[model samples]
Target: GGIITQTPKFLIGQEGQKLTLKCQQNFNHDTMYWYRQDSGKGLRLIYYSITENDLQKGDLSEGYDASREKKSSFSLTVTSAQKNEMAVFLCASSIRWGRGAETLYFGSGTRLTVL
Candidate 1:
């Protein structure tokens, strides 16, 4: 069994400030991803890394940055926090097999609030 751990379970930021969220997984998976969740909406991929030191931008990566310095960890940063906004950042991992089935294992998440 494995688990994903996210640090700073809650984050508070001021408008225009930069905020960072971190994630670590013991799943020994080959791929790691960061997602953003808005209230009442589905998860949107922000960034993903297929392997260490590799990064790929997703649909919502415009206002964010991500890094995979190690195989078991991934980090994300919000370029500029918006005022009075709230969102959840989720970290997930999956095994890559050519072009086959993959299941995402998600972390509890880091909730962000901007003032």
Candidate 2:
């Protein structure tokens, strides 16, 4: 019934360059999150926002920045790209965040490649 859209499905960046990714959801969910996925590292939470204009950093938020400009959109930026690295960035939304209260709907994801 709802969909999450992540823009620029593929990204190519140079080392040390800053790259940005974006997400938009039509579910009107109360919470939105950004996650980074790597081959062996699993999914790591990068940032989350409980509501518009509210930001919360996660374990991997150090090298990233996030913004919830509107309830329907969220954006993430990689402060410094790593050379020859590749990863997938995922965007998700939920009615409310909790251990077992709700399910997270994910976007197709944005794939990043650094040269």
Candidate 3:
């Protein structure tokens, strides 16, 4: 696997504003996923795509948009930012073959702040 790069290490936005985060990977993995990690909580899946141009909604898919732009890139957008909210958005890519053992690589994460 290769490295995953996320844009805007720290993002600040106002309440009710829309925000977008981008991720890029060189691994060319079979699947890519977007997850939200909140304080003191486990990661919650926002979206995932098994291939290019494919979009699949997960638990936190509401109020967000996701796109698998190409084999090496994925993006996520927040439709509306909540007031005084903070969270870390994580991007991950994995190669899952028949073995059921997938190799996953993750980006450092994009920190979001809504004032």
Model 1 pairs whose backbones collide: none
Ranking by lDDT: 2, 1, 3
Estimate the lDDT of model 1.
0.92
lDDT of 1 by residue, 1-115 (tens): 9999998899999999999899999989989999989989999999999888889999999989998989999999999999988998999999864666378999999999999
**Total backbone clashes of model 1?**
0
**Cα lDDT, all candidates:** 0.92, 0.94, 0.91
- Deviating ranges (above 4 Å) for candidate 3: none
Model 2 per-residue lDDT at 13:
96
Clashing pairs in 2: none
Highest lDDT against the true fold, candidate = 2
lDDT of 3 at 69: 87
How would you encode candidate 3's per-residue C-alpha lDDT over 4-84 as one tens digit per residue? 999978999998999999999998787899999999999999999888888999999999999888999999999999997
Candidate 2 lDDT tens digits, 53-87: 89999999988999899999999999999998799
